[model samples]
Target chain A: TTQEDPHWATPLSSFQGFEMIKILNDHPKNKSVFVHGKFRGHEEEAVVILEKTPFSEETLPFALSGETKLKVGLKNDIYGNYHGTPPAQVNGIKVSVVYPATPKHLVKYSQQQTYLVQETGDDYRNITLPFLQAEAFRIQWVYNILEHKQESERIVFEDPDKETGFILLPDMKWDLKQVNDLYLIAIVHKHGIKSLRDLTAEHLPLLHNILKKGQEAIQEKFSIPPCKLRIYLHYQPSYYHLHVHFTHLNFDAPGTGVERAHLLSDVIEHLEIMPDYYSKKTLAFCLRENDQLLAEFRKAGRVPQKSE
Target chain B: TTQEDPHWATPLSSFQGFEMIKILNDHPKNKSVFVHGKFRGHEEEAVVILEKTPFSEETLPFALSGETKLKVGLKNDIYGNYHGTPPAQVNGIKVSVVYPATPKHLVKYSQQQTYLVQETGDDYRNITLPFLQAEAFRIQWVYNILEHKQESERIVFEDPDKETGFILLPDMKWDLKQVNDLYLIAIVHKHGIKSLRDLTAEHLPLLHNILKKGQEAIQEKFSIPPCKLRIYLHYQPSYYHLHVHFTHLNFDAPGTGVERAHLLSDVIEHLEIMPDYYSKKTLAFCLRENDQLLAEFRKAGRVPQKSE
Candidate 1:
């Protein structure tokens, strides 16, 4: 009855009280009021509010039906103390907040949902649109990662001008199991370019520099002679990032086919003659059944829908 | 002077006399004559003839200075008996003819020469001229081989129409060590059809039939399901003879790249749509530094003269 007294409201844990406040705040039309009730499982009496409505004897049971007395008490008390600093201890006993454990199934379901969402987004970017549009999203993502230093651990060499760099990363399928069986992802840091198709005569100097510097670094780092190296790029890359692959010459890597792998030197020379050579040429590539780009190609009637 | 008597001339082994006669015959300008000489290291003497020239004691030493008496005797006797059958036994020693053993160095050199000749010829066929011209020689070689059944042991299937066939052979480098790790060379026995480029709508039915029958045969022979099979062909094949390669999909055999390998079904579909699609389209492929075709392309300004 003494509304001015700060102790008039029941003490509650911060978390529970905040949840109650959140529920009330979500219903903006309701005004604050007192509710008197016994929490569902306990003999202790407590007070709660739903807008300006007070809990009468008849409505008490419904108001405190599912939650335990301790839970209800904690919620209402926290809600009452919202505008003020909450007490560290309630009723002389140490007040602690414990979150309910999430079920294993729920945890797994949530994770799977997140993964599915990410995968679907990737599919949308990779398969639904033409290559140029698809490449925009890919280049943005790569630049974002580079800017954030997300791949710091993988960075092997970075040129002072930030125009070129290399990352020593392992391929999903290694052609060989030797210590030298590593893939050097040589990246031209210039943005917007998606693949060899985008390279032009303007990029020749940069390309030449990267190849020369990258080879030197590889030779020094791995103690492998230039003769032992094979550098090339795939037309239809696993992902749309302007990257050249450097592997041991003896390693018969997955995409090193003459049809698929354009030697870096050849690519540079090809650009030297025709700045838009790749853009004008009709390129061929392989696509797995599930590949989104393949579907896009099929939709455009560029390739047959039926696979062989 | 005792020329009429059969025993007047030394009873030489027919092979030795034939050798002497061959030497004289090779020098067509040298008429038939007789020569007498002591074998280089033997005490025996013999006579030989060259047109009408007669051998005398004074010239014996110089005439047979390099040969044994037995050799010279055999040559003269065989020559004298050219018009009539010579006795099988000579000097009571069965007239056994012994051939000098070939030198080890000479045998090795001859083998190397043969291999080099074959390699050079293959280079000429594959790289020197445009694909169409090069294919002419290739067709002729294939015809010769088929006529003579040069690779009979490798022939797995031969159609009665003589227009289609299969030869199972090992790839230069195998991706796997299994018994079924073999390359099925599917040949269209039509001499002028060099590759997919030469395929037209008229050839579609034959191409489709072969693909189906070939797959069935492969399944039956290897016990591998159709799912494991990958069939395709190279545009500018390592060699010009038109053939499709069939291998386990798991095997990443050389030349199975987008730039090179054209799926048989795709070829058929393409031909169906445009009878001369391949012929009209510009095909791209890689050539090593030593590839003769690359040089030709460079000379024609189709590609640059650079190796990567």
Candidate 2:
């Protein structure tokens, strides 16, 4: 059955015979056990997630074992996840192994995600423009990748057209495992289009091409259909390169928050109606307290200086 | 100390002598057990949350109880929560019990959140406006409360200005226990203004008054400074009549997703810059698949007919 089916319970149970590789994460309060280990007799590591189920009506009543009873409260009892964390209504740590482990998986699973703010058009003109003029963000690595000097083998699809073509590859954040938490990036061959602000009616064709081909390629490789894909672009992206993110609708990938992510379909439609929509519109986003962009805004007195 | 302090681990522990009240939620996979009991000798209920702490670097390795080993894999290994899940990096569920939970608290913490889509101005014109014209939503209860026919004692703040004044009351979603997951709604004293669409430059005084007085009132009572609060409005709001939401910045309240939430600060600024901003601009929001609004969009041919 497809992993997207909400009722499908992950199948890799019984770690009794599994060979251990590395512990990705283990926690008690916000409890999770992520291990990069191989199921016994397997050649390489398989991506599996282990979680200690909550005490459900069926299982929790049997929880007392004569040992010294200890107590706890997770550092974060956060309950605001909009994605609707699954109904974890049922004990021992459950396990389900997926794909192979990669170095990228290590970093992706480890670090915390950054919270972003919306940067309005006023911000675009007043702060983002000046920040870009200063060329504060570096994209040498993007150029290197486009030129095939780096991560060349990772490309899943490539359209060599310099104007509308792009190289599709697994983002460093994707673990190259099964498709549920899938993430991939498509970088356009064109160099002048640095970010969302650089797009115009002239680049709509390029955007469409990425949207179409990126979705098509992922489906071709992973059997996920286009309708199931969530394609979008990031404004004030981590890098200056013009790239598109392709993720499964079920994945709930990061950086897709409304404050930062602009749906490619909405954007294409916007530019369709007004060719200069991006050029004239005010975009919004959050700037970190210590970010250079925030500093630029503060320097111009558009944002308040740090009182903290 | 203020509950907003992230450095603080929740204080109430040792359910040891606590009188059991009711089980709010209990789960093994999603791993959360929310109880609604009170401290043993206390007269009134004080909120507390209990979570089994994870096996920390200092703890986990000693987890061998050598009991009957059962295993699992939670139904959801969801990793892409946009709101960062704290570093759950380290075993038994820990426990934390916060303020006395109200019936509202039970409702608030029970059901899962709904994922929303950004509704553009076109949606407002084609689907939302038409839906509103049909008066598909119910809000007679609001009128009842306004007339002091119901829940009169719940009003936290009220200004009698028909055009500019409003009444602040705890949203049924707030437990009225503590300030952290605080949620409140302010309904305008005037009745004609239905939703965000009805506002024009003429209402800036009202908007400004709500922003100023609302902030002041909350600060006066809760000690949460303006910067510590998140004040906003929801498009396609559950009920209309132009209500504004006031929540603690740290609460991570639901319906605050970008697609649905509009910052009061941004709204005020937009109106300040252009009186007819709401009228001229297209606002976007998600319509549930089965929502009456979606039916309106499809009937108008503004959205595709569902094949499903």
Candidate 3:
């Protein structure tokens, strides 16, 4: 019964109009005649082919001279569901078809028509996606520096919080003087957390310990008073790891601009008031033109595409 | 014996020349002729005047007409010493004259003639000298802030060693975050010691105390680590007061550039090695176009005057 089914006999639709007949008859010298139609709720105009032979009036739902075939392509499932790869998973994509000439609704339907579809999974990878991967690799390299114990000698102080292992070390490059011209960095041991985006109110105690322990160590080591010290974090950090920067108020290190630097105290206060503050907030930061993350955002419809 | 004084007679030659004659004869109506020439060992051109009628042919070694009179006005002493006030008590100056018409050798000599002299008190003051006075007033205002105890609440730390009383306070304007973004200014009680030039090995213990006490206070208050702190001083301070700056290394504050900032530890170490290190050093700093200090330096021959 499944073999004799009318749906299996031909790949074309049962609805036959004069345009369908004209298309079939006009292209007799050819094996197939392609007609435009919406298939399986996919409103994008699809090309359906009509075979010149195997015409049987007894089995056919429409009295046509030939059998029809739905040429929706191999990647599409039987129900005309598109399972092909997409540009990205985050946003919907628009598809269109331009018909040159068709007899059905000759004037009104002669132009172009478009449709939308939701993207998923690995479909999101694009040419710019490689850049995001490269950045991830860079962050990985910095993380490995700690794992290898290369900075063990440089560690000025450390807190024994196994969950958020905090450590302090002098920055490698210092433009300020060596005596009181001290520059230091504080970082967390949690590898899962990347930046402020991943931080929440629960991590407040760890941050507090880092700042407190760091201040104590700096006072003991460098002989700088608390009032003279400045501690803050960069919004778009140079590296993706969760870290804090401690510098002298007089040093004016790079990335201390209002747009980039976020004070640790303020961040703490903000979190105290609103637990998910950073997560809900829309952050603005400078990005190089070649940054693939920006391209991915553009492709996902999260940001507007740059003009040529 | 005073009547035979060679200095009082012509105000001319003990120094010989005819450019003196032309200077005396050119201003015919005036009884006094002011001609610039060197007197004493001082080489800067001094204003000298010659009188005509009192000229005894016996007193005058050279012949001159009865009509020739060149009497230069004087606020100077009989010994040719200037008593006018100077901007600062340092350096010597050079002066020159350009004559429009004279013989070829005299003309050539006139065009390039220049002499040097030590400036007397207040003799070097220009119209812009008022600015230097204003800056002194500004320093006095800051000093008064400490005296009146206006910053008592803001005084995070203080070390009383009588000779070098040290007090630390927050900088009024701060670009760094306040949590750890505290900017402290540590000033010496001895206001007479204006800059690093006044520092010597004798003040090392006082400086050491300031750093230590300030650090202890900061650690107790803000909980920032000593490794995270930075401390330094500016060479040509914004004001004429000896002060050290303590801040976080992350903050890129004004006057932190290599040309302006000097490390407190380096300064102390330098003093330990050489007591007069700062004073002996020829410090270079940028002066704004309108800075009165630059004008004073030019007048003192410490620096060359820029051509108009």
Candidate 4:
């Protein structure tokens, strides 16, 4: 039965028809719980992704209203430990829900397809450099913000210095709650500087300023200290424009994994030690199965082409 | 109602008694398919960690018996794409199952407790250095292997050069299958190199040798190419012995995370640029809530201690 979209590996109606039989399997991560059941007289298993949906504009006002029913419980991390402030004993928790999940959520909750893509200095020269040059990633939104055309009002901190200055603001994905998954991004004011590859000892001041002031801004605004923040950058960034990510140490945000994440501290250290560190070093990272760079590598015969 | 052990949040019997009411939620990462179910009219959601129990000496023969039932199907990865070898379409897949899982299975399958423990050079000198020196980690098994006193039959590669020599062999956890999750370890012969901190430009020869020969040995024996193999080392490794790990890129075996995993290539590059790169750079890794290092950090006032 060929269908329009192949993503629905099993039919939606089949899942709706599944009758609960017994307890089969479950886990706490992303609240994934499984039940064994029967479907149309065949011993079958149905997958129901029980996710705490994100809050949207429509749901936010309603949820805050008195009309909606609410139950509050202290949320403990998977370790059965509460992350509490010492004096107040206040634990950090999350509570909210929205409807109709998306594919990113599914990808997020699913197992990561991360792999190590270690390459020599020459491999970078041959494969990655060419891929970056040929790729045309649309980052107009970034330009709009940088040019003060859009999202300008939301900027948390900005230094107008072209060389060592950057604009820091809360990432749009964050819910604007300082306590819940604090996320911020710092876009450098310097143009022509692209990804981690372009960074050298000359750019150490910019990196240092971003780290220090980014943390200070968040600290002054939200009371989160420097140590509690996890700051890093993504290689092969979503856009060619340079940016640094500042997230709470506890927030397992996207692009924070080893395959992509290069700590700002480490970057600074590397540059301080060797002015041409990034230029000379071999860079390694994972390319998703669907990544365009991977396709480029396949074309270059560096990575084997996908089989039929 | 606290029991003798607080780890079991809810009683085990309660989970067994849970009755499936409806098909509610589920996911497939760890196969956590859930049903909107009820237990004894109390409206309970039971968590059953369906895990493939490892094969022991007792269960191995029974599972392979002709009398037992068997089911075989083509396995597809999360992307709905075959991780097939070009021309062969023989995707790398796992087809073994066991029963009655353990507690670590629950923890492993649960959300990772990893956090970035980034510390500056001063922090390392003040806190981490003392911690490592003061702590006593038992590693008699490491010595037994190096001395050819135990498990010497499994040694896949060895070089007896005292300064740069090492032993490469299958990790004990690997089930002797060269295809499925091929895991190998290389333990350095030179003593006193406790962790990544001890590495310097002088040890570049050793690291380079490990990289070259370890990849060659696996390629020769298992037919796995260097590009397809993921190799790395943990900063705060499970043991104090200096060792390197070689794994199939397809295998998401434990400890491949950015918080802990540092590629040998990157390490070598860091050293090549700066002889004392590791010593001067700020290091960070996640410390689990229950980890002794975290406790030590708390005791030393580097991290705030837990509140009641």
- Best candidate according to DockQ: 2
Q: State how far residue B62 of model 1 sits from its true place (Å).
A: 82
Chain A vs native chain A, TM-score per candidate: 0.52, 0.63, 0.53, 0.65
Candidate ranking (TM-score, best to worst)? 4, 2, 1, 3
Q: Pick the candidate with the highest lDDT.
A: 2
Comparing to the true complex, what docking class would candidate 1 get?
Answer: incorrect
Question: Tens digits of per-residue lDDT for model 4 on A97-170?
Answer: 11122343233333433335655567778877877777654566677778887668788999889999999988
Error of 3 at A118 (Å): 26
> Model 3 off-target regions past 4 Å?
A1-135, A175-180, A300-308, B1-308
The per-model DockQ list reads 0.01, 0.12, 0.01, 0.08
In candidate 3, residue B186 scores what lDDT?
Answer: 85
The estimated TM-scores of all candidates read: 0.39, 0.58, 0.31, 0.62
* Tens digit of per-residue lDDT, candidate 1, span A176-271: 346346666776666656677667788787788877888788767666655456677886676677778887654445677543576676577557
lDDT for position B144 in model 1: 46
User: What digit string (tens of lDDT, one per residue) describes model 1 on residues B1-308?
Assistant: 26674331232322222212111111112211122323334433333221111122222222212221111111221021001111111101101111121232122112110000111223334444354474353244355445545545545665545555434433422312243334677665656566665667877766876788777877677665544566778866655666778775544455665445666765775576558666544444544444445456556554444533
lDDT of each: 0.44, 0.62, 0.47, 0.60
Leading candidate by TM-score = 4
Please, what are the lDDT tens digits per residue for candidate 2 over residues B1-308? 47785422343323345555565544332356565555556555533334444544443333222221334212223221111112222234443444444567765554232223435567677667776878756778888888888898999899988889999999998998898778889998888787888788899999999999998999798776665567788877788789999887655576665556777876787677667768656565666456776777667765555542
